[model samples]
Target chain A: MSTPTHEMWTARLRGAWQRNLPIEKLLPDDQPAYVVSWIYVFGVATIAALGVIIASGVVLAFQGPAWYHTSDIGNFTNSMHFWSVQMFFAFMVIHLWGKFWMAAWRGNRVRTWITGAVAFVVSIATAFTGYLVQTNFDSQWISFEAKDGFNSMGVGAWFTVTNLGQMLLLHVAFLPLILGVLTLVHVLMVRRRGVVPPIDAVPGNMEVHK
Target chain B: MTGWLASFLDHPATYLKWGWFQISISNLIVILIMLALFAAAILIKFPKGRE
Candidate 1:
């Protein structure tokens, strides 16, 4: 009692999905068992560090540039934020390096790696903008100094580092928006692909190649 | 009011006052340098095929 139309439609749908995606490889629920190591924490750690940075950054933003110099709590909060940012960037660099060393970009993930690298560059630029928004003496110095470098590169007129308004908007709104989107894409790709197994994971391939 | 901002700004550069948890700029720079060297050491020691 199998209906030919239903079976034919199902076959066509399956073919379409297979044509659009390599369904044989990117199964939704399959992953290597070796992915259960403490080494996996580095990625989570980097994400947590970014969370701390954003929390601290919000407090700093609410207080504004004058508060860091005027209020005691503001100063302390600002210091915590500054330190958190430094730590966040440091951990992110490590996490990125670990992924690179493991060659996690292999298989169907080459585009993901390139997109992530672009995100890293953008994040660093966002951080530099945050520094300029501080408007403290250090911020002033870095701003003018960085402006000269940008001018020499011929993009200073377009970016205009002297404008605090523009810098603030970019830091709080634009860059964070870009970061959020990129992070979503990166996480989705990771979830879809799952963790890649180590090269020496085979039952008979465990012999050290080096 | 102006004097207070100036004084507060200068104080961070002088005697450390933010308790044990507080990190000084010099100490931060040293820790950063150590971290960089540590990462480099890992890269050198681990090499490519060994890890």
Candidate 2:
């Protein structure tokens, strides 16, 4: 007798998921000893900074622009958000540089590298939208200056940088959603693939006690 | 001295301009710090975990 359609589909999906990503690989107790490098810490640092950025941003969002502009607590939260973004970019750039030198795309990890690179590009757009929604003179100047650039690129019609409401929505909602999803996928890919071995080391055979 | 420091803090960021190239001192400092951190990350020895 043939299996029921729904049961077949569920079985296929479950089988694929378990076959591709076993629990042990997803959360391994021991990493390869070659993973003992300070450079590897930058990726975690970037994620930590992102956590702080999101926390402080949520606080700033609850308080209105005027509150952030005037109130001491609001100003402090805004500063936290700003500085966290700086840290995020700094650590991410360092992480990217380290990964590049390591040739981290080896061992069928090209998608992981691609997702990270695309996330960086999307982050720049997210940051640009952030600058546009700051509700300050700097934002004002930036919007006016950026509008011409967007227009020249022939995208100003849809991406109206000068429109504060639209820019705010993009900054707080659309761009962040994409960035968050990309980050999740990139990290999951890393866990599934395991860390890349050193350039000269043979994979799975060069375990050193570090 | 206090007044001068306050004035300096309140004023616009000082920029270093060389022809078409220009950068604020604050931004330059951040860049330099990032470079230093990157170099340190590469050079510094990582701790060995339990054998």
Q: What TM-score does the predicted chain A of each candidate obtain versus native chain A? A: 0.78, 0.94
lDDT for A39 in candidate 1 is 52
lDDT, candidate 1, A151-208, per-residue tens: 9999998898878888989999999889878877776677656665565567554333
Q: Write the per-residue lDDT of candidate 2 for residues A1-210, one digit (tens) a residue.
A: 999876898888988778878898787778887788798999999999999988888888888899999988887888899989999999999999899999999999999999999999999999888988999999999999999999999999998999999999999999999999999999989998988888988665866552
For model 1, residues B1-51, the per-residue Cα lDDT tens digits are 368877765664533457666666766776677467446635444323322
Candidate 2 lDDT over B1-51, as tens digits, reads: 268877778878999999999999999999899889999998998998877
Binned by DockQ into CAPRI classes (incorrect, acceptable, medium, high), candidate 2 is: medium
Model 1 off-target regions past 4 Å?
Answer: A1-32, A203-210, B1-51
**lDDT (0-100) at residue A201 of candidate 2?**
84
Which is the leading candidate under lDDT?
A: 2
Supply candidate 2's per-residue lDDT for A118.
Answer: 100
* Residue B40 shift from truth in candidate 1, angstroms: 13
* Model 2 residue A48 CA deviation in Å: 0.5
Against the native chain B, what TM-score does each candidate's chain B reach? 0.45, 0.79
